[model samples]
Target: MIAIIDYDAGNLTSVERAVRFLGEDCAVTRDLDLISKAERVIFPGVGAAGSAMESLKKYGLDKALHEAMKAGKPILGICLGTQIITSFSEENQGTPCLGLVKGEVLCFPDDMKSPEGEKLKVPHMGWNNVTVLKDHPVLADLRPEHQFYFVHSYYPMAKEAGNVLAETAYGLTFSSVMGRDNLIATQFHPEKSGKPGLALLKNFIAWKP
Candidate 1:
């Protein structure tokens, strides 16, 4: 069964629904045993990193996640889930994160401009296409035309360049997908990205690593 971790981080139901829609058995729960026993874990969330970390520790999901990663379980993170999996985030006055991945989450610069000299908006909300940097099973079916939904001002930056799986361009290019060993994360919300997003989740469900 797939466990959709519930840490008061928004978007849990949406991810659960998406998994169920794909005919996968999943549960949105904070129960430690459920998460530890699940074959796969989906860590998807929306919200501030500081509060999210508070909730994660409050339920001890942080340790559960660390254990899952160490066990080589196929773990997927989305958006805030993706950001907080790293070592730290510039949000909330430099909040420390789960440290599952060697990376940092940084906010976009205040003066971001598009290539055409147009001012780009912060909190990069909307659809964006990713440039796959390295091939991985979970992203095997993704095509060049496929775009994913993004809604955040901060983006993850892996300390190791090899961990960067994909990148997307906004005012500047940023890591859109990151993975190492059994853990994979997306800066975009695959659960809300329509067909392409579902394809990603479907691929994830079938991924061996």
Candidate 2:
């Protein structure tokens, strides 16, 4: 069974729907013991990092997630979920995150300019193409030319260069997907990305590492 962590974070329903659409067993819960024993965990989030972290701690889900990670179980994070997996984030007044991955989440400046000197959008919403950088089980049957749905203001700056699995271009090239060992995550909403995203999620479900 896959445990989907719920901490009052946005987009939980969408993720659960996607998982069920794939005909898989998933429980949306905040229970620590259930999560710890799950075959896999899907840490999906869409909200403020500070409040999210507070909720994680309030329910002791953070420690449970860490326990799963240390056990080498496969885990997937989305959007803010991915952000909190890092050390810190500039969101919601400089929130410190899980530190599960060695990196920091930084905000996109409002003044960020395009190559053509045009003002780029801060949150970088809509569909964007991701360039595959390395091979990973989660990326099975995914192509670099494919685009994914994204809605975010900040992006991850993974300190470990090899952790970056794929990247996408907006005003600048930013890390879109990252994986290390049994942990995998994406900045875009695979749940909302339609066919390609569903395919990726299917791969994630079957991925062992």
Task: For each candidate in the order shown, give its overall lDDT on alpha carbons.
Answer: 0.94, 0.91
Write down the TM-score of every candidate: 0.98, 0.97
Which sections of candidate 2 miss by over 4 Å? none
Candidate 1 lDDT over 1-209, as tens digits, reads 99999999898989989999999999999999999999999999999999999999999999999999999999999999999999999999999999998999999998999989999998899998999999999998889999899999998999999999999999888889999999999999999999989999999999996
How does residue 126 of candidate 1 score in lDDT? 96
lDDT of 2 at 39: 98
Alpha carbon deviation, residue 192, candidate 1 (Å): 0.9
Model 2, 1-209: lDDT tens digits are: 99999998999999999999999999999998899889999999898899999999999999998999999999999998998999999988899999988898988888888789999987899998888889887897788678899999999888898999998888777788877889999999999999999999999999987
Q: Count the backbone clashes (under 3 Å) in each candidate.
A: 0, 0
State the local distance difference test value for candidate 2: 0.91
**Structure candidate 1, residue pairs in collision:** none
